[model samples]
Target: MESASLDSRFSKPMLDGNRSAGSLEESVSPKPLPVDDSPSAPPKPPNGGFVAWMQVAGSWCLMFNCWGIVNSYGVFQTYYENEMLVYRTSSEIAWIGSIQAFLLLFIGALTGPLYDSGYFRLLLATGTFLMCLGMMMISICTELWQFVLAQGIVVGLGAGCLFIPSVAVLPLYFSSHLAFSIGVAGSGSGVGGIIYSIAFQQLQKSIGFGWASRVMGFISLVTLVFPLLIMRVRSSNPKQKRKVRKLFDSSALRELPFCLFLVWGFFGFAGVYMPLYYVGSYAIETKIMPPALAFYLIPILNAGSVIGRTVPNYAADKTGSLNMFIPTCFGLAVLSFAWIGIHNTPGLIVFIVLYGIFIGAFMTLPFSAVVKLSPHLGVIGVRMGMLCVICSFGILIGTPVGGAVLRQGGWISLQSFGGAALMVSTIFIIATRVAKVGAHPRQKV
Candidate 1:
């Protein structure tokens, strides 16, 4: 179904000496065991060990502080409307989040290339500083423009720097279990969502808006330290000089599966951000749930995601990432469609929980799938950056588009647009699978 040359080109180059005995796939055995390598060469991943597990934990905390806070934007969306920026139109306020989401992914264009050049500590340290600083700045901001600068652009840029490296490092640690490791780290987003949303809600009531944000900033500062100490580049070629380049990976763009997957991410994000940014407002506007319960909807959805992110990825290792991805994409589309018809409280609850689970799985698998198609593990950071850059445009516009549609045609129009984007994305997802492993059901792609 796909080009034969692409398969041959995908294999890794063998190192000199004993490493020349096997292919890269052979080097990555099914079990999580350490590989033997030359002392002068780069480090081989242990796959599973106290040191390796600690790396994953550090990455988890980074993801929690970065994307986790972004995932919880729905809580902010609701609060902006009801209290803080009450005078602003929904579309105006929505821009803050759209810009935040956009920059978080867009800046990967630069950070990804930097990460590939062995600047792990610099990226992680700089990102943590900017993110914490942004949060503290948000505490004192009272204007829309100030929020835009502090929360949207600064925080978003920090997140991109931290998120790309945190994810890229996992492939270096676990080849056989890459998907499961990514899922575990990615699950931090769900945990952060639950914790931050709850904290934002309770703290707003007790200490007011400014101090609530400052408290969260303080917590992020504390959590960020673990990653700084434990996470590091494998440093296999200790003496290799780093090369600087523009963020784009021109070579990766020529590959068919890679091209197809980027198309899928572009449309997929158009739908993905809709629920994460609007579910809180939807519950309140529909009046199916009370204000108190509606506020907790994001947390409830995130709670389900914690389970969804971890369990499906374990299955994905056995069944293949693309195999699991198709169903998750379908589920996201169906849920978007279903949201329009939901009227009762119980139905809303059920829908949110299912939405959380499916979307979590939907977002987690693509990283593993993309890495599998990559021609060189060394450039995985650049390839991932390119994908995120393409995906960034869709995220940039997703919330604002939804807000505009909601204003003009109400929830039905908004949900219909989201559902349509997701359904269209599935075609690309399937096409990518066909390109990778053809139509065979039994193949592990």
Candidate 2:
């Protein structure tokens, strides 16, 4: 009885000490600390553990399978025009890609919030099923509306599901190594573009359109398995409650940095994909290249882009995203207006190679900039979703506008339109910089 009483007496204080330790750990940890103090805490060590990096690589492969084929839609454009949708106008055909790009960005408005609320597994699985289904369906499509439903809507929705979740989840896994992780993931699009471009080109000749798309569908199925297996959320903090108490926060939109970035998002997307839609067509029309050779260039450009995406993102993490982004914007503008506008054979080839490099880098850096601009992990999804909404408008309209320009004056009109769009985009980028300067002028390095 005396020993039992002694044990009971020891257990009380042990419980109390454990409670106190829990409280103290929560107070000291980086996550629960105040926002003002977060920057002061030493940055998280690059804890890109093997499992974490593996997940990033897996996400990369998944993205290549889903969004990469979207990038290679140019090859399909050439094939579909001559074969399947022969009656469709170039402008009409352009909508297939436009709708696909539109869904990818527009759906993010909802998916981003869903992701922030912690439904990642559901989202990834649903996306994989939709993407595979869409690719398989596209093989059987013959009419314009059918293509729209299969390729445009279904594939677009799937891309949306896959793309944003991969991006949103990366920050949860790696804090200091965020850029490196994202850069690696972003390259999947480039690699996908190359692989799909070559595969579709060859399969179109050997097995015909139906089998060609089926091959892509099979490849997508294989690629998607990794993300389902490996990609996981690791943040310790609970998800931000998306209740009526927090439905809308207009105050966030008021921030100058976010507003400026919104404009940058608009301009950035407007010019980025114009080349993708036209490069193959331009190559064939110029008489210096065969249709097959021209289609192969998309992947070649994407190959260069793999380097472009990775290198610039590493630099952005060091030098500020805006610092890396401005020069790339200027490079794209110059390449589009001057080099691409003027070149015939050699100039077009050189322009595509150089432009692909800069544009790929440009695409990767913007997301890092968004994360830096809004450090509140809770709001990252909403902020990025809003940005995507604005950017979607640019993407939706940019290609149609390019198509209109092409119809009016042919190649010269398209070059001028692309060039002018880039210039306008650069203006917004500069304005973003000015806003940044004004917001933190006295703050020193």
Candidate 3:
């Protein structure tokens, strides 16, 4: 086409052995537009620098408050069942945490488009306020309905608002280090989990549940201040200049690989929170660990996750997110079975740590995989929000189902169920990779 266009503009087909008079005349009459061979390129991400890393730091703070508190639900699960909500069965108590996790992911689906529309600060501030308020509300609650409203509904909504921006912001700042940066920011969940769980554990003993909850709220209020101040969109010009996306766009669902990835996330996460919610209770009930020491299992698990989120994410930058994610899911499946057999403190601790690491890898890498599945950068937030919709349901049912399984058929059935969910997840992730990149193992997806 380029050759034909140039020929038509610069010259006409000539009679045999004769130069076209128009060719020579046409060349001097008007010059044709110059053509460059290469297509125009999009601007590159900054990849690294002061402002970019500052965004990462702010994102880390956001994550600390969002996922961090969610991860600490186990501490509350233990405390409530033993003291406050003892009248309720384990299955019933599990609903509070599951609902909390559910609403965080479900409501997040609506706010992703809002984030793209330059409502980031508004989302963050509203979320942080609700988070602090929910914690304070939790401090005052004695009834089941109050706990659900305060911790499950209010805190969950706050978390949902913050979730997308904390994650999606990194793509604007770093490309090569995207997984690693996300991993680093994501480690805040682990660190946050460890601190909050321990804080609640110690404080509840000395100050009672009400003051303990208030102290945690104060901590959330303080930590969130940093993110609120430093975080900004990558562009000085508002993203509101772009068309705002719809709240319920599921266009990515039309793609086969994405659908398969959603299945992978759904079943995989269905089992992920089971141990986190029940490990403390399981340890004490079975006499595998001392009662006083059992609550530490959550912190131990999160500490492992801090490492899991980091090293595997660094490796994912090299090996590909789907590749790293498949094996991690497999490890979690294996560890779920391993969790069923522990009879001693050392064994329980080992299971907790490994579970934490694998689940941490599972949590962070899936987002990267979702981003890779995205057709373009512009739709990543929406795609991520969609992914969260699938994952949130998994989280919603995971713990309560485990509690029901525990009540009905004992730990064996509960552990087996969790393992099977993850096994299916691993298989589908492998399928997602094959669908995306075909049978070539060496090629990056």
TM per candidate comes to 0.90, 0.85, 0.88
**How far in Å is the alpha carbon of 370 misplaced in model 1?**
0.7
Q: List the residue pairs that clash in candidate 2.
A: none
Which scores higher on TM-score, 1 or 2? 1
Q: On residues 258-290, what C-alpha lDDT tens digit does candidate 2 reach at each position?
A: 787788777778767778888777777777687
Give candidate 1's total backbone clashes. 2
Give the per-residue lDDT digits (tens) of candidate 3, residues 77-132. Answer: 98888899989988899888899889888988888768766798999999999999
Write model 1 residue lDDT over 1-445, tens digit each, in one string: 2324332232221222233223334432221212235455444556689877888898899888887898888898899988889898787898998898889888867776577566889998898899999989999999999999999998998888898777877766665566788889989989998999999988988999999999989988899988998887675565755455445656676778788899999999987778777877888877877677888988988888988899999897777778888889988998999988888889988998999999889768777676566654434555667888888898888778888988898889999999999998998999988887689888776
- Predicted structure 3: lDDT: 0.79
* Residue ranges of candidate 2 with Cα displaced over 4 Å: 1-46, 235-249, 339-344, 375-377, 438-445
Q: By TM-score, how accurate is candidate 1?
A: 0.90
lDDT (0 to 1) per candidate: 0.79, 0.71, 0.79
- lDDT value for model 2: 0.71
| Ranked candidates, highest lDDT first | 3, 1, 2
How large is the C-alpha RMSD of every model relative to the true structure? Answer: 4.0, 9.3, 11.1
Residue pairs that clash (backbone atoms under 3 angstroms), model 1: 42-236, 43-236
State candidate 2's TM-score.
Answer: 0.85
Candidate 1 global lDDT:
0.79
